[model samples]
Target chain A: MLLEVYAQTELRSRSQQHGGIAACLSLVLLLLVVSPSLAFAQDQAVAIHLIDMAQDSELSITAASLADGWYDESEDSRVSGYELSDGTPVKFADWYHTDWPDTRVDLLTQFGDDFGLLWGFSTGERGEKYTIDPSLRVGFVAQAHPAANSILSLTVRAVAWGNLNEQTCEGDYGEIGGVQTVNCRLAATFLPPEETLQYLAHAEPNRLHISLSYSASF
Target chain B: MTLRLKYLVTAAVAALALLGGASSSIAQTTSPVLRSWMSPDIADAWTQGYKGQKTTITIVDDFTSSSKFTGNLGTGSLLYRHGEWTRLEASMIAPLATIKSQSFYSGTTVPLAAGLNVLNLSYGMYARGTYSLSQLGWSAQESSIINYAKNGRAVIVKAAGNDGIAIGSVNAAGNKDFLNLALVGAPSALFVGALTRNGTVANPASLASYSNKAGTNTAVQSHFLVVGVESSKTGLAGTSFAAPIISGYASILGSKFTTATPTQITNQLLNTARKDTLLNYNAATYGMGEASLSRALAPLTIR
Candidate 1:
């Protein structure tokens, strides 16, 4: 039997107001490495995630809730805390964190187990004004036996996301020699886009990842 | 007639024509014509797209002389008058805010709307000074407004009357604005007084000649705010005009701070008022000081 694991950490910098894009990411990165064994041969492998830890400094979640009316109090169990954004405190509803499993299989059964394919998609996380479509990874893998019990694999994956097209187009006119001409121009959205890693984690449409992994039987 | 008498007659006719011409000049302009007098801070807020969206301002004032006009939404129901002018002024300040007109002549009671609400009371209830709040026999409207103010349910912007006396004091006309008396201790209520013009350090502004000053009462002093009326520029005058400006300001603040309570919004404005803009600034004279929209918007967080 063989076992494998993979994890990624993203750090974002911008904190936005409510109804605005909010992408909060952690800075710490932890990776667990597996040592290869040279005892017996292995057939199939399975992987599971241990933990995903992220930190947010700008916004702190609170447990107090305001009532439904102008300034009424609410007695709802579903409401966990308050979402304090920009300066307004709103009720935080249905807060959760989810992790989906990643799957891969051999595509070339007629040739050998050395060639495989990978495809996976996950749900998007929300921010102030923007919703982050995490990542959709799809690619191929190459496998080889480095030892009697250990197997090594090389994978090349294309990661893509659905980001907002914040470039809005507006019509304009100019007068030239008593004649009018219509010209369309693209404008920036409410919040300006940044080039930080946090912005990339939320707004980046696609990227390429090439990774190498090795696994062995216990 | 003598030559001197003829000269005097000609001068009298000239004076009458000049006075008529000035009246015509003012009449040519529409009511609440203070568009040019709007502060640059308001424009800046607009540029940032904070024009009081998702907020409602209820103008409770004299819409018509008829007792039948009671905030009815039917066609041709609202006749333009004092209430209409106040509504226009408030709408001009916060163009995106939803405005509801209610005539105080019919009934004093008003229904509160959902979300952030700003109540503009440009007109006050007057009575003899010997009477207390309990003895004033406030109608359901006054009671409701006072309750909202005391409980921080909504922002209540009341016009500091044009009597040129201290707030809650009996005027020379032997009458007292009981509304001011009832609202003295309210948490989110604001008494808006008029200034002669926009004040700055270089050209500090004074309270309008006709505006009521903040009295010795600490509660009234804490809730008072003065804004430029600029009647000379707008061809409109009075604390009634001043109240709508604050109402609009409260709406814009609501747009920015979507989840803030009416009390929070009110406190934000009062806390950020500019003292340097008022001439001889004092709590008894200027109260919190001139309402500064720019300074109010500059804060990242407000309690």
Candidate 2:
């Protein structure tokens, strides 16, 4: 009778152990299935949070006060920035010359985390008689990293001129005929870091941006 | 056992989805197109029948490889047919035609068929003197070619010699008398000069700067037209190449407007030229400015 009781006890213990192992195996399988989806969601949430941080960082308004100048005029610059309806930040760089102050405008649109587009336009007086004419350009910008502070941009543009005026002077009197000419350019711009905001405000705004521009896209 | 089977299936599905996403990203990248002077955009213009039809051109030159020459012509459209030749060199060979001896034809014999044919002569023999019609001896050969042109049997297009010296300059060699002087004094002949790719006039109009130039003198200037051609494949810089482009233009004109005479065609090209910096009514550098196809083809009105 004692042996029968011990045998029953052994069977129960064995069954319990088996049940525990099965439950553990099931839990491991569930984790394996859910880990990748969980990781993807975490990455997306982190990206959104970083974008929000960048948009709320700071705004600089140095470019708003410059005046337009002539063909040979000195530096003309303007700046403005704001958050868009889609949680994107939009920036403006306005260049004014003595010729056509109201006609010049440059715009940048930044999206969450790492994507954006930029556009620019300029028109002014060329010489004593002819208008320099209006030009338009558009480009794409992307953040190099998740930090979203620095960006690499590619620009394609077309410029045309009309109504060239000729000047008559001592020995310089020659007929200046009107011309219609078209040209294209590509460029890139870099944003200042949050820490460098004071330096940018104090430093002569880095208008000497480095970019490789081509005459034709093709 | 059922739980184990579900885990294995999920793992397989995840692996497959990752692989599919990677493949899709790779496919998103694309190659860029290359640019050329003879861009596809320009070539498309010819395929649409922009080349003129029904106008004939006569080519006069020594050793013209008719096969190679015709192949180039076919690129623009076949607007010309071969004609009789006056052999100036024993070594000269016609790649496209059956060559005959120089003396068989009389000057009065008509070589042209009526109704808008352009005569393209890639050859020139030098005869030195001031450009004067009387100064050029009218041989039976020269006279007949002239008469046909005068009667509008054809419009004669002659290549200005590649001799680099100004046109009408006396050749230093004793063989000056043998040079054919048709371009100097002949009103019937349109003397064509070569231009570099940048549209600048080429100096020394001969091979390797050996081309003849239009003289500021009245005779040479009266008959010349400048055209751009391909010289160097890498750096286009020669007039010989320019001549072909002009021929291509002429062929297109001939094919498009069958009713226009050679004179009308010539006038249209001259009238439509864009003025250059020189501003002289007619500068020696660019005769009637650069040839423009768009302006030349504007619709005609009865005056």
Candidate 3:
């Protein structure tokens, strides 16, 4: 296996060039200067403001975080130990979360202590299908100093996932009953509903995500 | 080298060795289930003098660097290494075919033997992240092999990794199998996956837990195949073991189609793969379906 060959060459080169943690920190600092907004929480209820600045007189970053995250998706349980039509308990092999090391850098810039903007990106981990999913997010952030000890924020962002592996889960077809039918039972997996649903999900026409989040912190 | 690659390859090799204890003695004494999966109706093919007499198979893998590794193909005390096992299996399937050996780590280009060359690559080349063919830095050896695949100079059979992910997908360690990308649209190449056991419509086989699938890529699915590795029964596991079966089939098919180009031989095996032999056979998961020597040989000539 040439596993070692690539490990020694491409990965090593990329590592050297990126300077790992140092490079990420530098990029975060640079973004903090020009980017905008207090961080809006992902689900909107409460935001963990990593960097909070209260001075309205100075231009500063309200939230800046660099996370090296591990992303992994578990296999559908149906394929794990489901019973066949004849009661044969079968478990298709599971190799989930085997390649999900990821990096995310998010920066929020505060303008005059009341308004902010969020800029973030994730070097998406390889999904179960083995494709890298790097994504970019751009959003508007609005925050108010409700009290000396409290902060409230509203955020709206659009995220676009990279289109790297376009053929990740394409449905295959064969002529059945003189008509081209999804050969889902054979080409992908033998499981019925699960396989069908799997193909349909991958065939989804949209890869963009739009979210509106509001956060409060004291 | 990343710890993940080492761990994966090592883990797979260790698992294969531990599962079946595929010693030389065990390898020589294949169980009935394994024999059937290795080549369906192989005896018939042998009787017809299509036992790979005119074919040459080049097995490129990691071999022992010691002088103990000789040119002798005769059954001796075989080492319990991966390359040794693959070479033994390939020869057992096509005993009359001339087999050549090369070490992937040697950094030398894999040589193509004259006349019906079947290159059995039971391993893959991997790199971190997804890279287009243009972005990947191909070594001399890889370039040669990719050129052979692209130009239809030989039938390249590659094991579609044991990560249980889709072919060309990055493994959990964040590395992609660039070899899969390199051969995606090649004129004559195969990505062999392993079935847990031999499959038939009446007794359909499921994929081995560790075998990579063809995924949704039409080009990849077109060149992918599944065969029973029967690890529990045979003690030999992994797509590494599944690949030799196809390599041997290619050799035998080459013997029958003496004048066929590598592309024809590849298409013959792929076009004749038995979907009925697989469980819910679809191109996404099973690719072209289970490879059947009996079916692949049924045709007199292929385009």
Candidate 4:
């Protein structure tokens, strides 16, 4: 089993899927070297996720205002505030993930033992217009095995993610492959936040990030 | 109690109830539909029953109907659009004011109506988003505007233009351009620049990015003022929208100063504008400042 893990790691390192997954695999190996006994004792299955935060909308500050001066609330120099379409002022921090619906799964797969942390996507060099915000998804997983084929395993999992607080939602529909698809839409979407980190820190009020279910086949 | 005494007491209470109902009704009529670009003084003026009543403001821009009369839509709606928009804003700020619109024509003459005190000119000659005195050289159309503004009874609220460029200096020849005559020379002419949004005047950032600013040592410093524009619907922002805001303010003041000339009304708006409300306040940028209808109506604000 030790030799098998080594060969697979060597193959994965040589293959093209290098940055995000390789970083997670390197950590698992470091743990095995730190405590060899723990690694040999148990049979475990772990899932690793590399999450890309939902593309956030721009800050409520109007573009024309930003072109001229920053909206510095501390100095009371404000062109506009995050608000509803009707013009009621809301806090800027509460405006995170208020428009985008779901986080795109950049990378998600289980490794040998347990799920690992998510990290940044550093695959290519990007310019000023491109934004990179990554997150780690953590969740509860339940596994089941039938008696006749005990080795054949399956897992049921529930996951949660942070999303918009009080976005005015409406229905949107489009046609694909001669079929109509329905989606939830924002009545009015704001511009993306001025800074990148603003996407992760600010959370929707009274609402946990979105939760999802996935049946794992191992 | 006797039958007659009971009846008399009931009648007295009913009369008192009627008076109370009438008072509330008057309050409702005074509440104007204020937009985002409007300063607080607009609402304050409305509360005092100043909705440009008994004042008629003529919109003197090209309605795109230079050859014919178009009701609301015209061939030059883009050019005509500004006049229509000016009327919309003017109505919101001054619901009761009578609005008369006139389109510009090169050789044809359009008469200025009697008792018209406010002229909203939300169009200008080609400035290309930069200020140049040469761009506004004397023309037939320009002369008509100048003659009307020079008319003592009416004040013309002109849009500085959308070219975001500073209104530049006069040439070495010292030729007085139409913009120079309208803004600096005439007491009844007030040029307006655009603001991104309204509510506060102190923030210089409030000026719309596309709105023109007066250059240093120019008449615009004292003659050009800025106000917020409504870019929500049209998806466009310019000094054109800003002019009507001042036009509405002038109309509101006209309701109060029934006997005052256009020059007096123009002076009242400029003199009482909110200067202290702006950051790094300057005449070149702010121009007297955002017109305060409340201040224009009453110099001392009664709490």
Q: Pick by DockQ: which candidate is best? A: 1
lDDT of each: 0.57, 0.33, 0.57, 0.45
- Model 1 residue A132 CA deviation (Å) reads 21
Q: Which parts of model 3 are misplaced by more than 4 Å?
A: A1-218, B1-37, B65-79, B130-132, B300-303
Candidate 3 per-residue C-alpha lDDT over A1-218 given as tens digits, one digit per residue, 9 for 90 to 100: 11111112111111333356544555555454333214443434333221321111000000000011111122111223222222233222221222224444444444434555655665644434333356676665665555665555555666666333312223321111111223122222212212233442121113344544434444
Count of residue pairs whose backbone atoms collide, per candidate: 12, 44, 21, 17
What DockQ does every candidate get? 0.03, 0.01, 0.01, 0.01
Better of 2 and 3 by lDDT: 3
Listing every candidate in turn, what is its Cα RMSD in Å to the true structure after a full C-alpha superposition? 17.7, 31.1, 26.4, 21.8
The residue-by-residue lDDT of candidate 4 on B1-303, one tens digit each, is 000000112212211122112100000002354444456556545443447777887776544432221222111224324445567666767777888776543323345665646878665432222334433334444566677667654788877755455654332223212343345556688888776666353344356665666667455566677766655533445675677778887777666555567877777667666655565667767766766554444322100
Off by over 4 Å in 4: A1-218, B1-32, B65-80, B127-141, B168-183, B199-205, B232-234, B300-303
Q: What is the CAPRI rating of model 2's predicted complex?
A: incorrect
lDDT for residue B16 in candidate 2, whole number 0-100 = 19
Q: Residue by residue across A48-142, what tens digits does model 4's lDDT show? A: 33323222222211211222322333233542222221223433323221222122233234344323232222221111112122233343322
Q: Give the DockQ of candidate 4.
A: 0.01
Top TM-score prediction, candidate number: 1
- After the best TM-score superposition of candidate 4, give how far the Cα of residue A169 lies from its true spot, in angstroms: 55
| Candidate 3 per-residue lDDT over residues B1-303, each given as its tens digit | 010112224322321222222211011112112253354445545433446777899887656533222222234344355677787788878878898987665546788777899998877765555445466555566678889999999999988888889998877867666777889999799999989888867889988777899999999999999988865544567787788889988988777556678988898778768787787778899999888776554422111
What is the alpha-carbon lDDT of model 1 when measured against the actual structure? 0.57
What ranking of all candidate models by TM-score puts the best one first?
1, 3, 4, 2
